[model samples]
Target: MTTLPPDETSQAATPAIDEPLERLARFAFDWADTLCDPDHGCGPYHRAWSMIRLLTKNSALPAGGAFIADGLHRAASGGRCRVLLAGAADTGLVALVLNALRAQEIEPEIVLADRCATTIEQNRLFARHLGMRFELHRCDISALTCRPVDAVVMHSFLNFLPVPARQAMIDALSRALRPGGLLIAHQRLDVGRRKHDPQPIKENRALLESAARARGYPDPLARAIGAAGADFWSNTFAHAPTPEAEFLVLLANAGFNLISLSRPLAAATNSPLFIAGQSRETPQAAILAERMPPR
Candidate 1:
């Protein structure tokens, strides 16, 4: 566990590091593009928008507005916070959160890290347009060293990871934050009615195949299913849904004292997962030590 030195000065430009993790991150971005395109039926960007709308309809604010408001409140309470916008696939949620922070008069030094080069570039362009400065890192969350941050956010990105990977990522994030720092995450967590059933990889493939057919893709549904199956086994299948208990345990292990968990007003039953916690203590060293023995 080598720790990177923290950026001390407010508004200082933090330099980006080019490492193996960064390269892998670039690869992930490229891979993600295939699935995220609007043409693709399962584009996470579109899915996230749908989820957001379902969550915050009651409030005058938009779907992700509550999350932004929560973060802003936390930053206001803590003062001059260093925030990490982890897995900022697209800039939609990040923009909302940043806007909320700005509204509260909190000068947040934001670090935007993600695996997608296109998204990173887009975010960079967007930030420039807004006259804002952010440190961009192209690296996987697991590969990142646990530097102290006042808060961390993962908007609609955690569900993409497998169960073990999600836990590992969360643990890493917990380590990255300073004591009492906030961890804001939004994802769909219900195993659906098929909780015991394995992720309907085959079913999802069928859906993709049907989508391809409807779109009149050159490839037949069988071929598309086969290709998607290959991709799933090779890449996406490793990630699993984090059970609610597991998620809570991971937070506790990471040293986060649960502050709040909100259910979406529009579709609380359908949307089983929501914002989890704002940690109040450093994660218990012993629990982490037991789970991850020193290499």
Candidate 2:
């Protein structure tokens, strides 16, 4: 019934960016990351992440509304829907995903599965604001143990997994779905990037600091946040990239039948709702798959 928080979206963009929502989501994620990440986060790291994410997320940020809503319609034959969100960095994505369900006028029974308590809690608050029916459980995707649901939705979530963990994560997602259940996702592709590879660190602290400063953050705050974000980003790039073919293979291996794998094209569906935040850094494809009946 709502799109992403209006502030995180651009009215000009397909899914208007909601600035205030983005700010709150960034801070929540940074706080969670500092607490849960291997880097052992501190106050500085949290602040840095909040600033860094807001500036840098432009490339990989857009999670559209229409594609998701369409997928739900296709997967569900006119009834209340049950959805599982595998993992998300912030509530921004959650709001965008839920907005799709809202637009369809479906009151979804939603479950959020994540390892971060703060991230889960933030979404809980947002869901409550809308009076949605939802539940939160703290768990890792690779070892997901939730009841089978009608659909599992993810946004740019594949590459976040470390290469070794990708297989387990995919399998877990499959397991989380019921027979004929759907998996709807949009993921970025890095051509020819292989398993076990790590994405090279592209931006340094100086660059992030410069970006933050340009966004009107003060000198000390900008530099500190930039440094923290730089280090945090470096530590989290274990999944270098996923080639298109490789990603398809993972889906197939998980017992999913491809429904559609598309780009945001003029004549194709969901184009109006897709706000492409993916630049050269994170070109994306929309994927909808179904868990087929067992042989």
Candidate 3:
């Protein structure tokens, strides 16, 4: 993918976020550097440091920002909107949800869950900024259980898990929501994908380098993270995405009914590779689903 000019894109829509985005990018760069001191063994998603840089460099606002806004507006019935964020690497989604809820005059009861402490702390930055109350959890979201909420939100998270775990996560999140609760997310999908698929850094180096240069981050040390990521990319795409049909089946088996699913403009998926003539160009789609109440 050729680099889209940030100024020519949607970055201008979110003003004054450059400062926080820089701080987060710098922190992620330092952490990624630590993961590479001896080797890439620590895993890029260990603290989701890789994602912070990639997100800051490749995309301005979260791709699911519009879905989050519309979902909340659709679900809010002049009452508090209870939400559960299944996983997050930054404050963008949470901030978007909060801002959208506020616009609807709906008080939000939000619970944000993730396994990485760094990301949990990273998400806290926005909580502090928005001055919104948030209940945070550091754990595998697939194993998470709680009182049913009104909706569950995520952004490109299902691809991080193998297909079985991905389904388990859907089931778990389904149980966490009240009957007829919403499941909203942006996910990459294609056919015949597997976790053991080979993903060479060579394929992504050009894309990474282009993004790194386009972002032109102010911090010099952090600026090198794109190169570092290209070199130490063992953890990049360590998992596989679900097939589109299988994903729909999983949601259905988990008692969810599809509300809407569509690919948004300028949004891309991570599974862009070719192995043995089989293409892995998984595309991203914005999904809004509702869990069916037991009869």
Enumerate clash totals for all models, in the order shown: 5, 14, 0
Query: Candidate 2 lDDT, tens digit per residue, 69-175?
Result: 77877766466778888876656556665556666777677788877666666677666666665678777788878888888888767876777788789999999
lDDT tens per residue, model 1, 1-295: 2222221211112112111222222233334445354432333332232222222211111134445456546644445767777775455445556656666767777788766555566566556766777788776787777457777776556666756677677777877776666777654354421221234444444544454455454465335333433243223311455565676787777666666554442221211112112111111000111112222
By TM-score, who's the top model here?
3
How displaced is residue 47 in candidate 3, in Å? 6.8
List of clashing residue pairs for candidate 1: 161-239, 162-239, 162-240, 163-240, 255-283
Q: lDDT for every model?
A: 0.48, 0.62, 0.62
CA shift at 202, candidate 1, in angstroms? 21
lDDT of 3 at 38: 36
User: Model 3 over residues 1-295: C-alpha lDDT tens digits?
Assistant: 1222121222323633332665665555556335322332434543334343344333245555556777877766557888999887566566667766776788888798877665666666656665656788877888886777888887778876766777888898899888877988766666333432334444455455555566664445334554455444444554665777888998998999998877655433222222123333444577889989976
Where is the poorest 10-residue window by lDDT in model 2?
A: 266-275
Model 2 Cα RMSD, Å?
7.2
TM per candidate: 0.55, 0.70, 0.71
Residue 28 C-alpha lDDT in model 1:
34
lDDT of 1: 0.48
Error of 3 at 56 (Å): 6.5
Which residue segments of model 1 deviate by more than 4 Å?
A: 1-62, 77-79, 192-239, 267-295
